[model samples]
Target: MSYKLIPPGKRRNRHYWLRGTIAGERVEVSTGCETRQAAQAWAADYVARLEGQRVPGIGEVVAFERAAELYKAAHPHLSKSDIRLVGAVAKYFRNKGKACHEVVHADLVAAADELKPGRAASTKNRKVIGPAAAVLHYAANNQWCTYQRIEKFWVSRKSNREPARDEDLAVLIANVEAPPRRKKFGRKADYNVAFKRLLLLMLYELGLRIGHLLTVRWDDVDLRAARLKVRIPKSDEIASLELSPVIVSELANLTSATGVNRPALGRGVDRRGRLFPWTTNRGVHAWLKPLTDRLGIKYTPHMSRHKLATDAQVLPDKKAAELGVWKDPRSLHRYQHVRPEAIPGRSAATLLALPAPDKRKAS
Candidate 1:
């Protein structure tokens, strides 16, 4: 078929585009580049993938909704926050009342264009940028419309910052460590000690999202394997995680006191299976803000993720993917809170190192 020139590379002069199959069919295809040789090579390989029914060179055409459904399937192991982000995208787009079948790249771009620079820029980051890009990227992969890049028009450049130093984070952790505030007669002391301890262990050591951590049930943990299964809510994927021995011991200690540390002045009733049963999302922020205030740690729940993704992610294309932060670094501004301390590398780790991701038997 014919090819259209499109802006290439995410950031700068990476102006390149590919020619893929016609809309709607699954047959793999690819074409177009500065050099005819490169185009021919990609085209040849794309046809091979199509013929074998392998992962085809995809197009960039599906609307936001269609693409998101595919993204959910692709990332069966996303974290809870990621699920929230996907949900946000779906809600925002659907709320517009535009038909999913009729939406196009122009509609998405027009939507992105409507975002104001000085706006609160809070929810827009995760809602508009991260998941929104995922919807587009998936389509681009399928040859939707040579996706140029995802822009962060929501976040003003004023608030962005480099990764928060771990040393700084440690300082913040210490401030909030006064043996859990408790009530003696009628005062409201530290709300929940065991849960707070668990939260810190997760943020500092386990690198878990507060949302997912709150959803964690005792059953998901494999003590023998020393791993936790972080199920990505949006994509419905399950990612295996490694726990440092220190956190494991801390969790073990807390489990021992589950009933002893129960609320209600005497003994807190331990729920049967759920590892944590938070009454609301307020507790997380309530403790974190006060803790950070006392410790002088200037960060939020997601800041830990950003810190972890930046520090831990060591692989290309993996830093964002594994951390479930953003589809690409450009959208980083909107979801800076999700920035991870580490970018996992391909050759180094095996947490999500599964073979034949697309071909694996349904679980």
Candidate 2:
């Protein structure tokens, strides 16, 4: 029963036209009404005239599940994470069997709110609300439903996680155990200690997301040029990062001692050879936890990203964004987690002095 009030073409009827189905036929009739509401009223009357007449074409209703499927099918460019998110949302709504027109803003908000208990605001927005909106927008574009805007969930500027310090990192790397001797004759030893050390340094220096860090291939490293190519999974972009001499030496020695470009760790190596050679991101996280606990410092993979962004804030905005592989300058706020004392300024209390008259008044 949906109808659209279309504006007049240059043919100059100079009136709103009703475009939809009437009596099982697609109709494009001038409503002769100046106001959109009146045109809609006339269209409603037209539909009423088609009551019990088996209107066939534009009156067809689509199920929510079908529309969601269509929406996902339409966007082949969506990243793996985005595809997972959209699929999660689709799974939630698959049982409801609601038509596209029946889905409203309240329904979307309720779905987003359902995620609030388990997820942070940013995650709720990104994983749930964002995908729901995309589906609705797609349906609207096909004229199956009206588009309702969903507001992105707000996140606080403050984060509980602090940055991992370079000093602590250096200490941790220095204290890691040396590799044991190979038992077999003529069998080359794997450098686990050296490998972990280089991994930690690269994590602290490169500021890559954990997924990207875990998947880095040996071929991506260019030691002679002092550069590394990191595949950023979220942005679907490859970032070329400059490497320091310390990072270069660590990588060179680790590769040289193992006598291979692939990580000596057997299970995680692909044909291309990953750098860390950990089977999963969780394995890498678990491996690093013991070292951080021993060093008496809190550490997470993301803290390294925060440390990088915090340190680079001194540079210009564009430069900092480039360093962090950020497309938007505003995204810097998400990565920066500087302590109050670390901010570049004297405190307001120190910068401003009380007037001498205040003492006189007290006396």
Candidate 3:
């Protein structure tokens, strides 16, 4: 009862005005309604919000679009892909005038279907359902609505894709290092080939996501210490890692070849110079595709990351997670696709070699 609505008068516009104290602050604003009753309701909700009280029927009053906007503003660290998905979801719900609390499981499922038609379930989950749920959960946290539990579409695991093999990568590297058959190209070609070889080596050896690898700057590496730091794109974390002797040698050679001397410690130099020429993940994939096709292998840059995770499974989960820059150790399950034969003491031959148990013992 601390708030009151004032009817339109000579000094005020046609819309009703609200004047009162809310949360110990004096407030005066147009209610955007001509009737006193409507203005009174608006003032009540506004006061409730400022007083930290749950607004009555808030789910029906607040739109999903508004909730999504607040969610985006609250999470500025969201990746570009996630931001785009949230924007798309907001646009879809904007025209519908869908209320944040009114959003249900079916609505998100339908949105996914419409927004990503004919796309894989994983695509729909990542691009539509995930963002929609995020908006709703954020709204719920602020007492704007109840939390929504959305069930994601089931994705099939029948893909034949396996992690990249060392031998296959070696073959690809050799192909890049080999001199061109035509003599039209001079010694300059050697330098270009050397650059490509280093790129391939780092992609597999470091086991970094293609996006993370491309963003690596010259300042992030230390040739003298055989160490480097990579900022994980997904979690926005810095991971300091030790480099192998082979990688260290390749990096030194590439640095000498580029003729760009590393700046002295404590010197102010431009740290924005990227190590690789490719900027986008698509660019790296497009460049590697033809080379992979010629070698009759289905290897991709992501497969190299999987290979690293799988090989690193030999270490403790915490250590493995550190090597891959995964914030959660459980995330290792998604990247690891260990071959059955590669498991110690659990090979097919070892299982078959075991003597059969006697039926008399059981009786």
Candidate 4:
């Protein structure tokens, strides 16, 4: 086992960073000491423990909080939301600072239970158990503790959002209030209402997550090419989607009316600005809720996504998955919701009611 002292960069902290390696597994930690000798001593002890060397009371054990930091450092490619969720789980155990070996199956179960109230099972699992399992798995891999307990936690649920029906969508569109367009001497007014309508239309037409949609910039749209550059927030990947004629037309009008020239709309589009600047995701939802409620439609931005996914069932599974940016085709199953009104009232038993002619056929 050996240790290396790494100098800090970007972060203007005075303390030196220490990296320890043992049996091909390396862990980098902050020594919290300025002197090289003290840092080296700390790394030596950490390496020895990770190597399964017992020193009296201190054995192969890492605090959950520290382990979380280590895990985060190890996975730099995790998305912003993913990092936040992991941090939330880590912060939950900050006060306790429980050691890896000290964590029991019941503790995880209790955590899951705590998250279960008022939250969807899927949400609870994804936010709580998932991160907890990851932390525990990291601990197990480092020989800090065994991971047999992770198997005990299992959380899943049917998807909450359902596809919006065509009729319902029509109602929503009809209910959408158009923004007041005041063209005084060819000057444009605030396009907030028009933008909201177009945003809803795009969300329905193209199955995009609201988070991804809201971050779209002018640079991301290609009007002449009829393509849109979409950034997937979960995977941090850029995907291209072909624009429909209606969408293309609307976008062209929007750009012309509000493009970087008008005083009202040109406030922020200096270099690279958002197409619809709402500031927060909550603001997007707040703008949407009134129209949906007025229409009496059980709808959300995600429901619009489901609507598009359901409509894309005619496409091949792979094609559908690709369009929806789903990593696995099975993930598409959750979005395959048929409108309740579309279901035929006649059951198979009723539809295939044949006469009892078979009884006389033998004769």
Top model by lDDT, which number? 3
lDDT of 1 at 293: 63
lDDT of candidate 1 over 1-363, digit per residue (tens): 333334445642443455445333533322445565675666666654544443334432344555566677787876677777776666667667643345555655555546424444555555556567776666666775565565554545433644455555544443444434356865544435556655655665545566767776666766556677766554456767776655555555563233443221223355346565464468577666766665555777666655555554344444555554333455444444544235542111121222322221212
Candidate 3 lDDT over 1-363, as tens digits, reads 376788998888799988877755788888899887888788777876776442324434577877787788778888788888999999999977798877889889889989899998999988998899888888888778887577899976444457777666766766654334456564444345555676777777676788887777777888778788888867778888777666666666553234543342434234347776668987666657767776676788888777766665356777667766777777666543742111121111221233542222111
Per-residue C-alpha lDDT of model 4 across residues 1-363, encoded as one tens digit per residue: 566888655672777797667645676778787777887787777776675432213245577877787788888888788789888877777766778778777776667676556776667678887888898888787787786656543444256577765555555554465334467677455446457657777876676888888888888888778788988856667999877767776666664234443222234334357777675789887757766665556778888667666665356666677777766666766543632111112111211133322211111
Please, what's the RMSD in Å of model 3?
11.5
> What is the clash tally of candidate 4?
0
lDDT of all predictions: 0.54, 0.66, 0.70, 0.66
Model 4 — which ten-residue stretch has the worst lDDT?
Answer: 342-351
lDDT, candidate 1, at 166: 57
What are the models' TM-scores?
0.48, 0.66, 0.72, 0.65
Steric clashes per prediction: 48, 0, 0, 0
Worst 10 residues of 1 by lDDT: 345-354
Give the higher-lDDT candidate: 1 or 4. 4
After superposition on all C-alphas, the RMSD of every candidate to the true structure, in Å, is 19.3, 16.3, 11.5, 13.7
Q: Report how far off residue 123 is in candidate 2 (Å).
A: 4.3
A best-first ranking of the candidates according to their TM-score comes to 3, 2, 4, 1
Query: Which residues of candidate 2, in runs, are more than 4 Å off?
Result: 1-61, 77-81, 113-123, 178-190, 256-272, 335-363
Q: Candidate 2, clashing residue pairs?
A: none
| Candidate with more favorable, higher TM-score: 2 or 3 | 3
